[model samples]
Target: MFTPILAISASLNDSQRIHALKVGANDFINKPFIEAELAARIKNMLLTQQLYQQIAMQKEALEKMAMTDQLTGLYNRHFLMPYVEKALSSAQRYNYPLSIVMIDLDKFKLINDDLGHDAGDKLLCGIAHILENNCRSEDAAIRLGGDEFLVVLPHCSLEQAKFKTETLRQAITELPPASHKTSASFGLSSTEEGNFIFEQLFSMADSAAYQAKMNGGNDICH
Candidate 1:
């Protein structure tokens, strides 16, 4: 929602905007408004409205395209980095704690092979739903393609992260989709890797993800 913007005429030989600002206007335009000036102001207002509208639309769109997994409607890796980077920076700056949990489907290959891709897709979507519902609104779950999902907890400890992951695991199992046939493994890391370049941060989290997959598929390894 764009804040209301105001514009006034400069008839008093002063940029009435200064006074108008005090009169409940967010941003103001000057006086002695010529037709062109009026046109420009109105144009600007309309343009601003349009610009703001475009910005709003873009924001909504970006939220969907950048964050959401197209198929599962879960947050995607593209959005994860920016969100995590910001969280990491803020956490470090404020002496707060931040952690990441990477999840991967266990026996995924067998499931895809036996159930077919459609079923596999359904499982992925179901998994995403379970993870999202199991998390706090502030917490985010993202898909890094395939059967992998990463959850970033900005102010959470390893214990909180573990509890959350367990919640998701239980949810996925307890409320399995129609076939009742998918399971996941998780790996968590909460060590403070300070001032990492973006790529390094991702690489670190990614390495943790790989570890989750390799060391016995269904438990959290931090």
Candidate 2:
């Protein structure tokens, strides 16, 4: 709440008025204050408060834009570290499992080259939608730049993560014809494997995704 304080004192002096302002008073009204003047000051204070609230809201919106991927509307890499740190801390404290899945679009370059960048973008957005739909409310889906994506699953076991990743892969495969037969490789890592470090978990998942790509895309490995 934006609270504006107006200090009114009948015996207030110059020094007292200064002190009141220094102690958080928005404005001070001395003795024999005119009703009209006081009303005008209150209106001005309310307007100032409204301006402050607008600035705060805009600041929040800008921060969200900084953290979000412009194309897919998913979280960007800039949001990854802090979110992972907080999630890992909570998982460690609660003794719950946390899993990470890395996804890489297969033949994305071919899609761009053959169908054009617009088509490729559409495919990417479609996959992003699949990731969002398959994840729980507590999970976070991030676009890690270009055609790479990551999903953070809290309180999920390794097996559960693998299953979820497979579901995402199948959904991508079955996308509408407009998506142009796009597919992705998925890799998974979990805290149940005794690794709580974010970098380590991410590396393992990334390696598994690479392996899936090596075996040909549209596969899940980990």
Winner by TM-score: 2
Whole-model lDDT for model 1 versus the true structure?
0.73
TM-score of 1: 0.69
Q: Under the 3 Å rule for N, CA and C atoms, how many clashes does model 2 have?
A: 0
Q: List the residue pairs that clash in candidate 2.
A: none
- Please give, for residues 74-111, the per-residue lDDT of candidate 1 as tens digits: 88877877787887788887887777877778888787
Q: Give residue 88's error in model 1 in angstroms.
A: 0.5
User: Could you tell me the lDDT of residue 118 within candidate 2?
Assistant: 85
Clashing residue pair totals per candidate (backbone < 3 A) = 5, 0
Worst 10 residues of 2 by lDDT: 174-183
Number of the top lDDT candidate = 2
